[model samples]
Target chain A: MNGFGYLRPDSVHEAAEAYAAHPGARFLAGGTNLVDLLKLGVERPSTLIDIGRLPLDSVQELSDGGLRVGATVRNSDLAADPRVRDRYPALSQALLAGASAQLRNAATTGGNLLQRTRCPYFQDLDKPCNKREPGSGCGARDGVHRDHAVLGHSPQCIATHPSDMAVALAALDAQVELYSTAGTRRLPVADFYRLPGEHPERDTWIRPGELITGVRLPAATAGAPSAYRKARDRASYAFALASVAVVLRIQDGVVDQVGIAFGGLAHRPWRARHTELALLGAPATPAAFEGAVALELAHAEPLRDNAYKVPLARNLALDVLNRLAPAPAPA
Target chain B: MTSAPQPGHHSEVTLRVNGKPHTLRVDHRRVLLDLLREELDLTGSKKGCDHGQCGACTVLVDGRRLNSCLLLAVALDGSEITTVEGLGGDGDEPHPLQRAFLDRDAFQCGYCTPGQLCSALGMLAEAAAGHPSHVTGPTAPSGRPVPLDRSEIRERMSGNLCRCGAYPRIVEAIEDVIP
Candidate 1:
């Protein structure tokens, strides 16, 4: 690991000030993904503002019948929380499906959302990855493209977003509360991750000094249907090949509202607006899901290696929707 | 920005391991694995895969199991740690999982044994706390507690890799704690 100045700030304001002063500084929380990336030379911040000391680890109830999860809350803690377990099992299930017990114990919520992709080309410093270096060629485009992105990918980059929690948050319409030296701000979770269009170097829309304070869930959509299904090579501790998070409100045996996001297949958590439109007011059946997937995958440009993800995603969508059909009626 | 490799300054960190406090000055870059083995001479926490892949360095950090190699010594300040050396209560009585491993002969190379024992203890607590396993249903039946089965045990114990094909014995040792 490169030797960098490490400052453990006591408060969020101090940490934000530290980041503003040092343009090349990155906040360290749990340091599971960030440390691994730094060791691989994918990210080399001159200074590390350790924010783990900040008293920001809690799961408090919002007045709007939602949750306010502190960014520093450990993944294990948030997932194992009783309220999160029963009320919002999508988030808990997503967390449980990620990394291992040991890693989840050390991984923080803020850090998990900020984790970079696991593409082989991105991790290998020798390879030319546009996400690592803008204007540089994307080696994953031609070589080792199995885990590369198929949707929302540009010629510059085609890497998948690898966070399991972010997808669930997107489905839940969670809003990210950000604090900077100037003031505080909020961004919808859908707006947090930026699609790799022309500039793949910019993976997120977060500003230089902006600190992720908390991810707040909006008012719960009553009778909401939510499910997270991930397909992978292994049963545990492996990155996903393709996954889908579906939040549907099925009323009168039809899809009244649907929120869909795809992981391991896009630059960001690929929010399927097209699929959502197709499924709205449509019957919640296998045939309806197949058509919605078809519309979304229309723009998907799968490379030579990852054509399998197209069908993998379709089947995953169908399976999750089928399981979600029997949920809303009882509620 | 290129970060130059600068030598870290040593700080005095006091850690309570197995109910005993040990005070020592360790460099920021000194990994916890080396600190346990070299400084405190607690070699029970083995170092198999130093990159957190193998759970050989599984030690309790603030009463939770974590890979020791990935953690730095500076990170463990004010934390209560428990290693294989302290798993047995006060060193007089061996932990139930420890005795079970011995009775079952759950090791061959004896390298992955420490991590296995520590992780088993941690896994048991997690199960008892009703922490849902990835392999189990999200809504695992409410009232009657579930027993840890083969697939459940294998999925929970996947972090600790055994190279000598000793998983059978390891599973046997863990299954005794079902009651």
Candidate 2:
């Protein structure tokens, strides 16, 4: 790994100043992703601002009944938090479903959301990845594209986001709290990430010196059953081949409210807004679920090696909705 | 604490490992796993993948299991770290988990034993503290002890891979030690 300077700022304002002072400095939270990227030579920051010690590790209940999770809160603690487990079960489940216990223990919430794609081409410095070096070209687009994106992808890059937690946050309508020298601002999770259009280097809307402070989750959907289902190469310790996060409310065999998001299928967490629109007030049946998913995926343009994802996502969506549906009354 | 190091300079890092404090100068890029193995000569924590993918470098940092390879030595200043060397008694008395591994013959080549033992110890503590795994059903409340059944053990230990296929014995060894 390349040698770099290190700074441990105690407060957010100090961190912002440190970033502004150092041109090529990167915020180090948990160091699960940043350190790995440094070793791979994908990232070459001149300095590392260690934000792990900041007093941003709390998981507090917001005044409006929502939950505010600090940036440095480890994934393990966040998953095991009582408020998170009881209110947003899907978020907890999603966090648990990701990486191993050891990784989760060290990975922070903000770092998890800002994690880079795990595309083999992107990680291989020898290959031409537009995300790594703009205008170079994309190897995954023509090479092993099995794990690439099926939606929100362009000819320049087809790499999919590898975060299971972001998918759940997208489904939960979570908002991010960002801070920098300019001041503080908030953005919905869905709008924070962007598609890889012509410039895949910019994974998020965050500017150069911006740092994520925390995330705010709206109140739980009362009486709604939510679930996160991941289909991976292995049962554990593997990224999802396809995953679904759903919060469904059914009343009198009709879908009253629904929240849907897909992972491993797009450049960003694929918020199934179109599918949710089709499912709302629709009959709670496998046929209806299938139609809604199909409508949402109608714009999907799967590559050569990832066509299987289309059916896998559809089947997973059906299974999730089926499990959320109310059981039939006894005859 | 010393001021932050300048670019391309080494920093003085103080790490408390297994009840001993050792201060050393290391580059900012030095990982905790390498520092323990090279600088301190505490080679108990093996480096398998040199990344977080493999659990060979698993160690307890502040009572929680973390991949030491993914942690920078400078980042762990003043943190208490426990490795496989700390699992036994002061003398030759091995920890109960270590003894159970011996009885169950839980290893073949033994390259991954240190990580397996540390991970198991951490897993047991997490279960005792009512932390739930993915296999635990959705409705299971937080802070409620999750049952350490066969599947639960397997799911929890999935991060540590044994190329020799000593998984059954490893699971048995862990099961025997769980109280």
Q: Report DockQ per prediction, comma-separated.
A: 0.41, 0.53
Expressed as tens digits, the lDDT of each residue in A184-289 for candidate 1 is 9899888899988888788788888989999998766878858789999987888889988888888898999888888889878888899999999998887888
lDDT of 2 by residue, B116-152 (tens): 9999999999998888889987677679888799999
Over 4 Å off in model 2, which ranges? A328-331, B1-8
Error of 2 at A26 (Å): 0.3
How high is the TM-score of chain B in model 2? 0.93
**Residue A113 of candidate 1: its Cα lDDT?**
86
Kindly give the stretch of ten consecutive residues in candidate 2 chain B with the minimal lDDT sum: B1-10
Candidate 2 lDDT score relative to the true structure: 0.91
Every candidate's fraction of true contacts kept comes to: 0.33, 0.69
